[model samples]
Target: MAGDEDMKEGGLDWAAAYRRLDRLAAATDAAATTDPEQEREVMDERARRLARTVSARATPGHLLELVHFHAGEQDYALETRFVREVLRSSEQRVTLPGAPEQLRGVVLLHGEVLAVVELSPLFGRPAPTHHGPVLVVGQGRAELGLRADRVEEVLSVSRDALLPPPPALGAQERTLVAGLTREGIIVLEGEALLRDGRLFFDLSEERVS
Candidate 1:
């Protein structure tokens, strides 16, 4: 296993990779000191290059990385690979009238419009009042903004930790829920949920102010 191999070799050269990326960013910033348009172009190019480099280094296949969060007074875990980033939800979210109840609104994230999903209603629970961070997830043309009452942590657990979902979970929920972690966190198949055309609300047709 890669994790075991890492343990044996101390670990991957994360420090060196970080330093290299930092230096690349600094160099990009220094090169973008000209006009605003030129700076934006240069920054975007460098950022894409940096992202490619980071994504090329894959996480261990045997390790299930999860980002735990709360939505309807219950904890849920999403595979970290599907999570792009987590950001505070305090920013003004634009609501699209006539949209489904599950759709909270749209939030601008990194120059892209992400449809914010209120998951409580999906499970027949009252939405949690505590505003927390939004988990940004992207899959092809669909980008989702999942709000949580609290973001627990990014955990790396062995694949063996995942257990099959209980039969008590309804059909729809079971489809979305991959399994349960060893500690009993409900592990969600976020990609499956995003791909579910019936559950997904396309914000592309809606106007965002």
Candidate 2:
């Protein structure tokens, strides 16, 4: 059929993928299983399926993968390539003296102190006294965690779909945002974020001395 041919031109059999997702959904037990681990796995699978759906909406070769997340009351996204991992925030966070106000604290990540950034103030909101999960991102020495109130899921969008930041955003806010999607996700400029010197602190000095 023409639909199959259309999907072929895009390089993905999106229809087949959607049908398989439907089967998975139908097989899920409505009763809700008691196993936390199993439930987490199921949710993750659903997220993956949703990402595929978004990718299908975008043109095949032009798709840009993003990790969609919630920060404060707003929605945001970062290119998947910059994000190394998502870590659960810990209450044991240690604050360092003389760091920028945006620096929330440091979290123990894989036997190292990973600096955490709080962007709420940049958007005219009061900083959260308690940090949320950390989005591990950046390049080399700049790699650190960006606090998020909640991580929704990973997604994909067409390059053409990213529209310019709306006029409602303040000057500072405009500088941080690369584009906004129809879904209301403000896509931050990953390279600009990585190059921001404020995000980096010489942690190597604190390392074995």
RMSD each, Å? 16.0, 18.0
Per-residue lDDT tens digits of candidate 1, residues 21-66? 3454555456666567888875687587448434633363677777
Q: Judge candidate 1 against the unseen true structure and give its global Cα lDDT, from 0 to 1.
A: 0.64
Error of 2 at 191 (Å): 0.6
Candidate 2 ranges beyond 4 A from true positions: 1-61, 97-99, 140-142, 170-172, 204-209
| TM-scores of all predicted structures | 0.65, 0.62
CA lDDT of each prediction against the hidden true structure:
0.64, 0.67
Top-lDDT structure, candidate number? 2
Q: How far off is model 1, as Cα RMSD?
A: 16.0
Q: Per model, state how many residue pairs clash.
A: 0, 0
How well does candidate 2 score on lDDT at residue 113?
58
